[model samples]
Each structure stands twice: as structure tokens, then as C-alpha cells.
Target: MADFKELSRLLEEILEQGPAGCGCAVARNGEILFEEYHGVKDLESGEPITADSVYRQYSTTKVAVCTGAMMLLERGKFLLNDPIYEYFPEWKDTMVAQPEEDGSYRVRPAKRPILIRDCFSMAMGIGYGGTDYTHQAAEKVRAQLRANVGEYTLQQEIKAMAEVPVAFDPGTHWLYGFGHELVAGLIEVVSGKGVGQFLKEELFEPLDMKNTGYHYFGDIRERMVTTYLLKEDGSREASPYFQRDELFEPEAKYEGGGAGLFSTVRDYLALTQMLACGGEYQGRKIMGRKTIDLMRCNQLNEQQLKEFRNPYLEGYGYGCGVRTLMDPSAGVNSSVGEFGWTGMLGSYVSIDPAEKLSLVYMHNLFPNREAYIHPRIRNIVYGVL
Candidate 1:
């Protein structure tokens, strides 16, 4: 058991350091030993956050989607090296990046096909659609995505995305955002079910994650916390609440696999616990030990590793859904061999397999102004261990 008072104090400090509205939980070996919530769920309504408060998980959704894919892989549904175009034929003979006359690169035919492993590596053409050659192509698709102007099917969104050119050759580098969405689409194709239905059948229902899903509904909607974005002046801006009535509409239907899904701390901890125990929880095997081993192993070469590293992640290698390389002296103070991912909305979950510990910190706030809390919380948890 953990020192409850110490953990509580740390949680209190974290809440004090940031905005009052936040939820956090820590679990070990499938048991939630410490959990806490502070401030309001909805600032306007003054609704307090609870253990059941569900927040938009953003990129943390990648872990769940990746787990879904890995479960199918363990079942021999597909192989990692298989060409993705084999599953989504529309992606075959896609375009690559080439320099235009003005020194800006434009999309042309790809020399090779995008593969299944490329989806896992986030090498697929999807990205943040920012001002880069890759995102330039992504931006064109984004405009089309926004222009649909009505209820759009997932297939339509994917097809529109398919028309966009890839940023780089598959397997050349890691670019986050699109691979998980492609994986979600692949799940639909292979399972003969919608991504939501397939996840409910294979994961949510099986794991008894009653409160978790792609969209908020019923009583779950009431528990959903409003997301926030911190401004440069340190003020908080509230995000629009996701409404079931408005779902399937163009803006909402995008349902990005990489950064969509809302979950509670309790619910997400169950997931990490399952991973920590080598793919078993409460005698249920979501994946085999060997499959879990493969997911956690470093998949990137040294050169690939260099390309994947960034300000948020330094000295890390892409595993299935988590980041796995560890350099203790890299100055992050996180454990070596720890694997986990963070959400854009101030949510983080990491499993330290070496220490048999997992930490989950979630907040609905965006533009995580006080970014120090994540590392500090990790340090506290590691110190206690």
C-alpha cells in the first residue's frame, strides 16, 4: 500500500499549483490506491468534480485505440508488416512530398505503399495541419473536412483524408495524430463493425468500462467536465461541451481516433493496470503476455529515435501506444522503461514497469499553462516508490 497522507498532500499541492478544477488517480497492480478530485466540473455551474467526472482524454485515446488494434493483432487478424493499403485500398499508390517551383514541396506519387506498422509509428499522413509541408497537405483536407457542412460518415472523412498526400514515406519518421485514426478505420474494416461498436464489443464491455466511450451520453453526460484553455495572461477559457444532439455534424463527426474519447481517472487507471499486469486484469486477458511485450518494446532505430524526440518527449522511442526510451540524466526524473502518453488537454498516464507502478493525472484544461505539474507529480510518485 502507498502512504495515503503523503499522496494526498502531493495532490493538494498539485491542485494548489494549478487551477482548482482537476482530477487525478494512481493505481498499482490493478488496484486504485489513491484518487482525488478538486474544484468544479463545470465552472459556470459550479459542479464539483468527482471520482466519476469524465474529461476529454485527447491523445490519451491513442492508448485505447492502439490496445484495440493490438488485441486484433494477437488474434492474428493482421500482421504489423502488412501494407496498410491492403486493408484500405484507397491508400495504395498515394502521393509523396516533392518541392514545387517556388521551393515549397507539393504532393506527388509515393514510391512505396504505407504499411500496417506505419500506422502504429504515426507515420501515416495525418497530422496537426500546421504550417509544414505535411500539414500543408493536411490543411487542404482539413478545409474539405470543414466544408462538408452536414452530417458526414466516418468513411467520408477518411476518404477525404486519403485524397491528401502523405508528409513523408511511411516508416521514415514519427508524426503524431493520424496513425491512430487510420488504425481505428482499419479496426472497422477488419472487424466488420463501426469503430465505436467494435471498441464496445471488444474492450469497453469486456473490461466493464461502463463509463467510458467515444462520446458522452445519459448520466455520463452529466458527469462530463467542461474543457478549458489557459491563456497567455494565465486566465482560463472554457471549451464548448460536446452535445449528443449535435454529434455526427461536420465539426463533431471528425471523431479523431488519435485525440478523441472522454474518460474518468478510475476508468483510465483500469486500462494502465491491464497493461502493467502484462495484458491481464481480474483474470481477463485482453492481450497475451507476448503481445504486451511486443507493444512495450522499442520499435524505432537510433536515427528514427532522434526524429521522434521533441520538447515534450526527449530520449523516447515509440512503442505501440506509449513512449519507451529512458535516459535518467535527460533531466525529466521519470523512470527508465516507463511507458505512457499524455493528452493535449493536460492529461498524463505513465506505467513504470520497472517499479510496478502507474500514475494517471487528468485535467480538462487546455493550453496547460503551468506545465511543471506533470513532471513534479511524476517525481513525487517516483520518490514515494
Candidate 2:
């Protein structure tokens, strides 16, 4: 057993410096070595965070979404190297942007078509943020989302994204963009079901992740934790109440995968545990051992590594929707091949297959202070082991 005193100290440190309420759990080989929560779920009522507290998973939702898609790959639904346009049709022979001397980009024919692997690896060239062509393409989809809330669908939004020129030739560069949309879209097409429905039937239900999904249900609203805005003066303010759809509602207004999914610490730990434990939970196998292996393998190349330069991800390599530790020297005392990804609200998942160890940390803070918070949490979890 590991002494989790340092981990507790981190919970205290975050309350003082970041989120109002937070929770963390560390599991190894199906056994929880450490699990703890601190502070209040709502500062106004002083209601404490418990095992039932649900959170907006933000980008941490990527791990599960990718895992769900990988199950299809294991079943031979589609090959990663296959072109996405084969299924979507519109994405076939997509145009690429060329940069000119006037600081503007022009459209050009792509050397190679966007492959399914490129979407999984975020190399599909759809930019999630920017003022350029990529932004316009993605933003048009978002504007439609804002314009027709509760009625617009991800299928519609992703098709809107598919209509524009790509940021680069597929597989030529690495940019954290809207590739997961295509991944989920592929799942919808191949499975002949919505992404949320397929995941619920295939991933969530099998893993017993009762509180995890794209939309909330039952008492989840009452149990949901509040997200906060941490100010520079070390004060935290409550963010506005976010509107949520009812149980079994279609998530036509929300972004699927990374930007969607409401979950709890316990629910998400089940996912990380399954991945770290060779895709098994209890007696059931949600994914194959080698399939899990392929998902975490580094997919980026030499030039792509230079482009995947996230600040907290200095020593990592881009895998299928997750970051795999590539340089231990540059990492935060983590193991080589340690793979996971964080959410927009400071939630994190770090999986080490070598030890069959994994960590799930959750907090509700915008600007997700990953540089200061995540590395410390990861090192503290490792320090006692």
C-alpha cells in the first residue's frame, strides 16, 4: 500500500489555490490504492463532495470516446489507414491550405487524402481554434449549434466542418482540432447507431459506469458539482449555472466526445482502470489487450512531435486521442509509455500499463491550471509508491 499523505496535501493545495471542491482516486490492477475528496461541492451551501458527485468531464471524455471507437476497430469495422471520405463521402479528396508571403493561406490539393488514422491521431488538420480557414470551418458549425440549440446535431456540425479546406495535408502535421468529431462520426456510421447510444450499450453499461454519459439523468442534476472561476487574487468565483438536457435526451446541441460527457470520479476511474488493466473490468473484457496497446502507441512522427508542443505535455507523444510519455527525462517523474489526457476543467487521467497503475483527478476550474496542478498531482501520486 502506498502512503497517500502527499496526495492529501495536494487536495489541500488545490483548495487553497484552485477549485473549490475536488476529488482524486488512484487504482492499480483493479484495486484502489488511494481515493480521497475534499472541500465543498457548493461553497454557498457547504455541501461536501462525495462519491456521487458528478462533473463535466470536458476533454477527459476523449479517452472513453477513443476507447469506444477502438472497440469497433477490434471488431474489424474499419481500418485506421482507410480514408474517412470513404464513409462520409464529402471528406474525400479534401483541399489543404497553403501559406503565402502575405501572411494569408491559399487552398491547394492534398498530397494524400485524410485517413481514419489521421482523425484518431488528431492529424486530420481540422483546427479547433484559430482565426484562419480552419476556424471559419469549425466556427460555422458552432454558430449553427448556437443558432439552433437543442435541434442541431453533431452529424450536422461535423458535416459542416467537412465542407471546408483542411489546415494541412492529412498526416503531414499535428494539430489538436476537431478530429474526434470524425472519429465519433465514423462510429455512428459503422455501428449504425448514435455515438452516445453505442457507447452506452458497449462501453458504459458493460463497465457499470452508471453516472457517465453525454447527458444527465435521474438525480444527477442534484448531485452535480459546481465549477468555479479562479481569479488572480487567489479568490474563486462560482461560474454560471449551465443548462443540461433531461435523461435520454438527444445531444443535438453539444459537441460529442471530448467536449461532451458528464461523469463522476468513480465512473471515470472505471474507464482508466479498464484501459490500464488490459481492457478488462472485473470479469468482463471491454477491449482486447493488444487493442489497448495499439491505442496508446505513439502515432506522431518527427515533425509532428515539434507541432504537439503543449506546455504540460513537454515530454509526451501524441497517440490516438491521448498523450503517451515518450521522454521520461522531460516528464514529471512519470514512467515511459504512461498515457492519458486532461479535461478543460482540470480533470486528468494518467495510466501506466507497466505497473497496471492509473490515477483519476477531478476538479471544477476553468483555465484548468494543468501546468501547476497536474504535474504536482501526478508526481505526488508516484512519490509514495
Candidate 3:
């Protein structure tokens, strides 16, 4: 049992410090045990955060995207050990990016090929596509996206990834980058459908997640909460929603698998609940129980785990695409096999399989203060449970 009153008070404190508004929900055994919204969706108009309010999921989108990919794996559509080159031949001879002392970078032929499993585990050395030579290559794709808009297709940009040298050899060290984007590309190729369309058909539709997708639908955009930037002084300024994040494009290819999803607390709960229930929603099996187990198993070695260090992820291991709890004291509510991911904008999704419990916490704040906020929410949720 949970003390809903205490939970509400704690969430109120969250709005006092971070995002202008937020929404959260928790479910156990397919029943929502706790659900609530706090603060205003927009500070100016005073629009309230509601169950239907949509949010840009950012990297949190990986959970659902990975689930869809794992579905294909469960069906034997692809094998984890298969090299990515098998699907994208351009990746056949990828190179490594080695930074020189002179502040420049050089390329070295990769020691091994990127396997499908590497993408799932973030061991493909893809740097979130922003800083390094390889990331710059990814940035070039986005630059083109900004310039030409719809002209730069997801496949075209993903294929162009081969031209960039990876930060490290695939399967060597874990680097959080565009590996999942590549996974999304793989999903597209394997399904013979666009990534967005494939998820709509395979996961969203089956779960009746009508409010979740990569773009605006019906009133989704209209119902979105305002994004806020939290200043060092602990004040929040309402910023434009979704524009800086490049979200809510109705006709977008949504190439980034690690980010670019729009969903609500209720809509995404459908996903976490299904995962918590071992891939079953209602009576239908979205995926095999064993596959879900495999997805939560720790996939990193001792050295790779070092590269995955962060405050919020202290006690977790990188599995499939979610953080698998290895040591509960590291920061989980209270389960060994708990797993899920976070969006860049302060949102978190946690699924604890032992108790068939899951939680979705949503807020849109820049410099999300994930280290301070996420653990508090996790503790409260688990403490009450």
C-alpha cells in the first residue's frame, strides 16, 4: 500500500524546484495504484497537467523502441550476434576515432564489427551524436535535417553514419550514443516499415496507446505541457515546448531511437505495465517472457560498467536499452531486476518485475537535475510500496 498523500506532497516539492509542471503514475499487477498530476502545464495560461498531457520522451523513448526491437528478436527475425553490416552494408568497414594530442582526431580501422547486441547494450561506441568526430558525423545528419527538413530521410542519415569513425571499437567500451538510432534503423529494415509506423502497429495499437507516438496527432500538440528551464537560483522559466527538442513533427521519420517520442503518463504506462507483466498486455502476449528476462539481464563487463557511471545510474547495469538494477542500494526503489530509462528532460520510467510494479514520472526541464530528483521519487514510490 502507498501513502498517496505523502506522494502528493513530495511531488509538490518537485514543482517548487524543477519543471513548471509534471505528471506521474504507478501500476502494479496491471492496476494503477497511484496516479497524479502536479503544478501547471503552462505557467502563463495556468493550464494544468492532466492525464492526457503529452511530453517529448527524449531518450526515455528507448524503452519502447527497444521493446519493439526485442519483439523481432523473439520472433527470430534477427540474431544478436549478427553484424550490423548484414543489414547496412555501408557499415561493413567502420573505423575508430582516436583523438590526437593536438586537439584533432584520426581514424583507425575498427578491430571488430558492430553486432546487433552491441546496439542493445550501448557498447557500439556511438557517442550520443554530438561532440566527437563520429558524433559530428551524426551532427552533420541533423544539420542537414535542420537545413532541408523532410528531404533528409532517416535511412539516408543512418546510412551516412558509416562515414564517421566511432569513438571506440564496437563492443569495447559503453558509450551512450546513437546506437539505438541504429537499432531503430535496423527495426525499420527488418520490419519493412518506417520506424514510427512499425511501433504504431506492433506496440502502440495493441496496447491502445492512442496518445503515444513520435509526432502530433489530433490534439496531442495542443495538450502538451510547457517546457521550462530551471535556473541555478531554483526558479523555472517557461521555454518554448518541443521546438528546441525537434519534437512533434507530424510527418517526421523520428530517426533517433534514443529520443523523439511523445507520450502521456497513461499512454506510456501501458508500455511499462506490459513490460512489468512480462510482455503481456491483457491476455495477449506482446513478447515472450524469456525475451523480457533476457532484455533485463546485465550486459556489461566490469570495465564497460565503469564507462556507464552516473549518479542516477549508480546501482544499475546497461541491459538491452534499460538500466538493470544490479545493487538495489545503487538507487532502485526495491527490486533486483528493476529496469527502465530516463528522458533528457527529467522524466523517468521504472519497472520492477519482482512485484509487477512500474512507475512513470514526467517533467520537462532543461538541465533536468536528474541526479537530485529521480532518486527521491524512486525512494518515495518504493518506500510506500
lDDT of 3: 0.85
Residue-level lDDT of model 2, residues 153-269, one tens digit each, is 667766666767888889989988789988888889999998888999998999899998776578877888888887789887887643233322543445475568888898888
Give the better candidate number (1 or 2) by TM-score. 2
Residue pairs that clash (backbone atoms under 3 angstroms), model 3 = 58-259, 128-177
lDDT of every model, 2 decimals: 0.74, 0.84, 0.85
Candidate 1: stretches off by over 4 Å: 1-6, 100-102, 145-149, 241-254, 332-335
* Pairwise TM-score winner, candidates 1 and 3: 3
Q: Could you tell me the lDDT of residue 139 within candidate 2?
A: 77
Q: Residues 178-278, candidate 1: write the lDDT tens digits.
A: 77778888888888887777878888877778877776566876677777666677666675652232442323554656866778888788788877777
Q: Write the per-residue lDDT of candidate 3 for residues 248-307, one digit (tens) a residue.
A: 676654456888788899988989999999888888988888899999999999999998
Once fitted onto the true fold, the runs of candidate 2 whose alpha carbons sit more than 4 angstroms away are: 141-150, 241-255
Return the lDDT, model 1, position 378. Answer: 71
